[model samples]
Target: MSPKMVPLERATAPAWRRRPAALLAIALAWPLARLSPHRLRGALEFLSRGAQPVTAAEAEDARNAILGLSVRHGGPRCLERSIAIALICRLSGGWPDWCTGVSTHPFEAHAWVEADGRAIGENPDEITHFFITMKVSVSS
Candidate 1:
């Protein structure tokens, strides 16, 4: 079946989390995006190793922060966005499952972060059609 594109809602971080630190982390995503995929994944893996499990709420906060910063600074696309989210979580001493996947019918690729097996800021069904190409776990 062809994968359907779902319009995702933007998550908003709590006012308390709208600080310079979060924005700074989001800003760093730009340079990271310039790296090759392999290097990007390796960097994220290094940062995520031995990280604590990120709670749903924490994941939401990071997602929101990324989205917000992206709006203001033209946030990076899927891969960079996912990496940024994971890195933001790492800053708080936790990490989410970073993933990249592709769908065959129309040939699309996407990247996202997950906590407890749930994709953050994405429609659950949207990712079902994708075959995961790479997944980096913080605990691993």
Candidate 2:
């Protein structure tokens, strides 16, 4: 028989109960991040080289393709995530590690993958606070 599915009501308790759940997710992602393998790295490099700069739709395709491939083959890592994002930018003619400063947002700074100077993802501005990204020049 198929396993019974638990509803959100059954799974989620309270804010207090969610702490462990959040921690568990981070704990899982941390090791997987560390465990990112060379094969995935190679794939990122390969995809980046093959991908050409294009429009946002093209970039999205590259993002999905590389991320899906990495999840299937590489497991996980910061590199995997960044590379997937970067590949999208590269295909969309945007490079990774691109940065900009926002004077309105308390002098906040943001780095994001871009194509034609447009941010690629939802609220790309949010990335600035989370990661201090540096651009790496990858040889195609």
Candidate 3:
């Protein structure tokens, strides 16, 4: 039998917008979410080319700005949200590492963006805990 899929829960509420670029990236990323993971990664990689790497603070600001638009954050870690964060950051002239990971114990999937070698809002200790299935880091 096929495993039943469960919808992810929202972790953030709509708050403080005014970021037009982030809103645009969120809209663009919404369609990209329909693509397969591998394809989505490629698309983001293509889009991020030529953008300089962002620092941890910069990435966190991008993340908060993306969240400001109030895209649904999944337990504060959603694939679509992370993709939007990367796109928004890139569109804003910075690039952060986008990551996809899985934990095998009970089978959990998560996605997040990182900069300066750590997931923007996650604990440093949890950084290496998951087995990263895919990642697209800056290339310039």
Candidate 4:
């Protein structure tokens, strides 16, 4: 029998202002996801630290794919995948991983990207723990 397929999260559409750009990006990552693991890793390496612009579509695509696949696979590791993908998206825009953390109770892992050590989010304080494994420097 074929292995059971895990489901992925549903992605919400980006704001109307960014729909076009985001859509284009989403389409791009879909194919990239199919690349060999080594190539994907290399591409992600460049993407994570590259100073390229991250369009809304790319973020939306990545967010959707990670959420959906993790939910389908039904494992805690999904969070890491989510964080990694998110980090890559942020990195492409010249952001860097400042910290990482996990939920005390459930052991959910999350990484934060910061510019100059300051966290960016609607509520930065919500992301605590502040532990980081490795950091990829982005050139100024």
Which RMSD values do the candidates have, in order?
A: 3.5, 14.2, 4.0, 8.1
**Candidate 3 global lDDT:** 0.76
Which candidate should be chosen as best, given lDDT against the real structure? 1
lDDT of 3 at 15: 42
Tens-digit lDDT track of model 4 for 54-138: 4445544444444443343124333344344555455346334334455654444554444444543314665554455434444
lDDT of each: 0.76, 0.41, 0.76, 0.45
lDDT per residue, candidate 3, 26-58, as tens digits?
788778878987788788888888999989888
Candidate 2 Cα errors over 4 Å, as ranges: 1-52, 72-76, 84-112, 130-133, 136-140
Candidate 2 lDDT over 1-140, as tens digits, reads 45333222112222453344333433333343353345434444454564455566644444444433334312323343444456445544544433223333334333334555455443555544443333333345
**Candidate 3, TM-score vs. the true structure?**
0.81
lDDT of 3 at 140: 48
Give the better candidate number (1 or 3) by TM-score: 1
Prediction-by-prediction clash tally: 1, 2, 0, 8
Q: Please, what are the lDDT tens digits per residue for candidate 1 over residues 1-140?
A: 75554444454553654556576676777788788889887877788888998988899788787776565422226776787788888888999988889998778888888898788877688788999988888756
Using lDDT as the measure, name the better of candidate 2 and candidate 4.
4
Show where candidate 1 strays beyond 4 Å. 1-18, 72-76
* Error in Å for residue 59 of model 1: 0.4
